[model samples]
Target chain A: MKIKREYMELGALATLALVLLVAFPLLLGGFYLNLAGKYLSFAFVAIGIVLTWGYGGILSLGQGIFFGLGGYALAMFLKIEASGSNLPDFMIWSGIKVMPAWWAPFSNIYITLAAIVLIPATMAFVFSYLVFKKRVSGVYFAIVTLALALTFTVLLVGQQSYTGGENGITNFTTFLGYDIYSHASTYAIYYTEIVLLLFVAMGSTAVIRSRLGNVVIAIRDREDRVRFSGYNTAAIKAFIFMLGALFASIGGAFFTIQAGLISPTVVGVTSSIEMVVYAAVGGRLSVPGAVLGALVVGFLQFYLSNNFPHIWLFFLGALFILVVTAMPNGLMGLLDRFALSRE
Target chain B: MELMQGQQGVIFDGANVPAARRGHCELSIRNLSVSFDGFKAVDDLSLHIAQDELRVIIGPNGAGKTTLLDMICGKTRPMAGQIFLNDLNLTNLSDFNIVRAGVGRKFQNPSVYEDLSVAENLEISIPRGRGALASLFFRRTKVVKEEIRDMARIVFLDDLLDRRAGHLSHGQKQWLEIGMLLMQAPKLLLLDEPVAGMSPREREQTAELLKVLSVGRSVVVIEHDMDFVRSIAHTVTVLHQGRLLVEGSADEVQADPRVIDVYLGH
Candidate 1:
C-alpha cells in the first residue's frame, strides 16, 4: 500500500512532464515561453535544494556560488567564441593585452561544458566534506555557505579585467556558430531544458528511493545513531551536497543560455537565499513540487515586480513568512492533505 | 575455577582471572583514564570481556558506567588508555571505525530512527554497502529481506516491520535498537540501561533476548535493576566512583562488603 503511494507520486511527475512538454508550448506565445524557460531553469536549483535541504537536511545558503560558477563557465566560452581570435571585449576595455590562461580553457566547448558541472561539484564536495568532517552543521554550516556566496560575488565583481567585472560576461550571440536569438533556436533550447529538467527530477527521485537516500534521512534525524551504526555520516552528507551543486550548476548553465547573460547579481547572497525560497515554497520534500514552486514563485515575482516594483521584495518576504509559519510543508503538503481528505 | 556451559549455554563463573588462560578475550581495556576539569570521570579502569559472556555492570549514579561505554565505542577519547578488540587497538579509532571494528553500542535512551519504518531501521544497519556511493546503488535483495524478517522475529517486531518507528512503544524502540546492533553482527555489544523504561514483562523478554544474543559474542550491560542483572548476567562487575570495586557472580557481588558499602546499601 505504501509502495503504491510512491508510484502514484511518480505518476504525478509523469503527468507534470506531459504538461510541460506539450501543454506549455501549445498555449504560451514566444515571450511567455521564454519566460517559462527561465523559471524552469530555476527549477534545477529548487530540485537541488530539495535533495540537500529537504532530504539530506543540509541547508546550504550559498548555492548561488555553484550557480554562478556554471553560468560563468558557459558564459566565458560564449564570450570567447563571439570575440573570435581577439580578447573578449571586457578584457580589451580593461587594457588586458593577452587572454588569461584560465580563459583559454573556456574557449573549447567540451571543456566549458565539463567545467560547468565539475567545478561546482568538486567545490561543493570538498567544502562540505571538510565542514561536515569536523561536525560543523545546522546553522553554522548555513552561515559558512552564506559567507561563501558573499565572498564569491565580491570576487566576481572585483575581477574587472578577467571576469568582466560588475557588468559580467554578456553580449554573446551564438553557441557553436548557431544563432541563439533566432526563434527556432529559442524553442529548441526551451525543449532541451525541459527534457533535461525532467531527467534530473527523475534521477533525484530514484536517489530518494534508494538505500543511500534512507541513510541520508537517517543521518538527518539521528546523526549520532547513524554514526554508531557504522556509516560515515560525513561522506554521505558530502555526496548529497555535491549532487545538489551538480544540479544547480546545470541550472545555471541553462539560465545563461536562456537569459543570455551571467552576472554577480544573479549569483549573490540574495539570489542564493531566493533559490532556497523556491524549494521551501514548492514543497522541499517533493521533487515535482519544487519545479512547480519555481514556476509559480518565478511568475509571481515577474508579475508583481512589473506591476508593483517597489513592493515585490516585501511581498516575497511576506510569502516566505506565510509558508514557513502556516504551511511549513509548502504547496505539496497542501496537495497531500487534500488528497488524503478526498480518499 | 573451571569453565562450564550453564543451562543458558554460555556462562562464566570466575572471569576475573586473567583472560589469557581461558581461550581469548573479545574486548580488553587497560588503564583507561579520562578526566573533565580535573575531575576523573573514569579513572584507571582495566577490564576484560570474554567471548560468549554476558557481563552486567551495576553501579550507582555518577559511577562512570556510561562513560566507560562511551570510551569503548570511541565516543569519548580517554586521556590515557588502550582498548583492544582481539589484537586491534581501538582507543584512537573514530566512532564509526570502532563500530566497524566490531563494537556495537546502544545509548541509554532509545535512539532508533523514529521517522523510518522498522524494516528501514534494520536495513540501514546491515554492515554491507557502507560507502556513500555504494549505498546509493544498494538493492534490497530477497536474502536481505529475509534477514530483516528473521531479525525482526528475534526482536519480536516481525509484525511491526512496516510501522513507523516513532509509533512504536518504548520497549519496542529499545528492541529495534538492539535489532539494529544485531544487524551489524558486532563481536562485542555495549548496552547502557537497555531496559530503563521497559515494563516488567518487557524486562523479562529483554533479559531472555540478551542471553540469546550473547551465545556467540560478548555483551556488556549497565543496569540498576538487580533482579534483571541476576537473570541475564554470566558474571557481574561492579563500578563505583570510576573504579572497579568487585567482579563476581551476582550472588557473590550482592554479598561483598565493598559492593554493599558503595551501592547496594542504598
Candidate 2:
C-alpha cells in the first residue's frame, strides 16, 4: 500500500481497509454478506454522529429518529407498491378499509425516493436550527435529543391505524415485481447493498476530508472562538445534521430493501443508542472506526448469542463496559496508541 | 470581494471599524456585572477599548479579570449592563451571535482541537470569519486564502500549516489561538492569559506580537506578567472583584496608590 507519512503512518491501514471492503462482500458466503450489509447501515448512523455530534459537538442521540423515519418512509412506499390489488399484510389484519391519504404520494417510486431524501433533510434542518440557535448544549442537549428519539418511537407505536402501531410497517417490499424470498434474489440484494455501502463510506470520507470538514472540527473544539470568527454556527450545525440524516435514511431504505420487512424495533431508541456504542467502539473521529465498531459489535451479537444465549447480553454489557472505561478511544484509538508506542 | 479581507490586515487600531456614524464602533461597556449565584464575580464594571488600542488588564488571582473578558465575549451574561460594539447593542445575543457582532476571544487554555491538522483548524475558523458554510462544496475562496496567509505570516506558522495543532509548541499554540482570533477578525480581540505557561523568550515574543498587532483593531489582554502588561498595553485597566479599580496609561495606573493598595494588593 502507498502510505502517506503524515497519517501517523495510517495511510497503509486505510488502503488495506479499502481493499478488504471491496473483497469481503464478494468472498463472504450469503449469510455473512447479509450480516455485513447490516453492519454498513449501522456505520451510516455512525457517520451521522461523526458529523453533527463528533465534529460539531452536538450530541444528538435523536439520529435514530431520522434513521427510523427514513426506514418508515421507504417501508410505507414498498407496502404501497406491493399491495397492487390486495391490501398490505398488516392493513388487512388492522381492519383498515382503504390506504390512508399520506400513503398515496408513495405510490410513485420517484416521489417515494424523493420524499425519502427531502422529508428527513427538512426535519433535521428545522429541529437542529431550533436547538442550536437556542444554544442548548452539553448534558441538557443530550437529554433533549434523547427525549426526541423516545417521543418519536412512541408516536410510531401509538399510531395504530397509520403506522401499524408497535408492529411497524413490515411483511412488505418486493423489488420491481420480483419475489425477494429466494436465495438468488438475496444475493442480488447483497451485492446492491454492498455497492450502496461503499458509496456511503466514500461519500462520508470525502466530506470529512474537505474544507467544511474543518469547520465541523472547529465547532467541536471551540464554538465561542468559531462564532466570533463570523460563522453562523447554528446554520452550519443544522446543515450537517440534515446531511447526516439523509445518509442514515438512505441506509435505512437499503436496510428495508434487503430484509423485505420494516418494524419499530430496528429503528427504536435502543437501536439508536446502539449506533452510539458502535461509533464509540470504533472511535468517533475515525471513519473506519465506525465500520470496525459495527462489524465487531454485530459479529459479537450474532456469535455470542448462538453459543451462550442466556449470558450473551451480560457478556456484551461487560465487553462494552471494558471498552468504555479502558479504551475510551475505542478499538481504533487503541490500535493507534499501540502503533504510536511502537514507533 | 477579494481585497475586503485585506482591509483589516495586520493592524491593531480599531479605527478601521465600519460604522454607521462618523466614529468607529469601538467597544463600550457600562455598569457590567456578572455573578455566580450571588457571589458577584464581576460587579459594576465599566470600560472602553478604542480602535487599534492594545489595552492590558491586570489583577491578582480571582480578581474578576477573566470574568470581565467572559462577559464582553458573550460567554457569560451580566445581570445588569450595556455593551456596545461599534454602537451595536450586544446585551441580548448569545456567544455565537456576539462573536458575529465582531469580537474575538482566546481561551486561557489551548482550545484548538488536537485531533485536527493545523490547516483544518485554520479552514474551520476561516469560513466562519469569512461567513462561509461547512458544506462539501466550500473550497478555500481567494479571500479565505489571503486571510489565512496573512495570519500564518504573523505567527511564523506558514511552514506548519499542514501539521496538527496538537503537536505545536506552547508558544506555537498561543500563536495558533491568536491566529484563530485573527480569523475571527473581530473589531475587539479579547485574549485571556496569552502567555501564562511559556518560556521567557516565548513570552517576550508574544509581548512583541501584541504590540505589533495593536495598530488597527481594539485589543483587550489579561495578563499576570507585569512586564508583559507594561510592554504592550497602550492603556491599562485594573480589575478587582469583577470591577474596575483604575484606568489610564500603563505607567500611570502602576504608580496609582489606589490601584496598588486595593486592586494589585501589593
RMSD of each: 4.2, 4.3
Can you list the residue pairs that collide in candidate 1? Answer: none
Q: Candidate 1, residues B161-220: lDDT per residue as tens digits?
A: 999999999999999999899888788899999998999999999988888677667899
Per residue, candidate 1 scores C-alpha lDDT tens digits across A1-343 of 4675697678779988988999999999888998999888889999999999999899999999898988899999888888988889999998999889988988889999999888999999998999999999999999999998999999999998988888888999899989888988889999999999999999999999888989999998989889999998999999999999999999999999889899999999999999999999989999999999999999999999999988888999999999999998899878877776786
Score chain A of each prediction against the true chain A by TM-score and list the results. 0.98, 0.91
Stretches off by above 4 angstroms in model 1 are B1-25
Docking class of 2: acceptable
Predicted chain A of candidate 1: TM-score: 0.98
My TM-score estimates for the predictions, one after another, are 0.96, 0.84
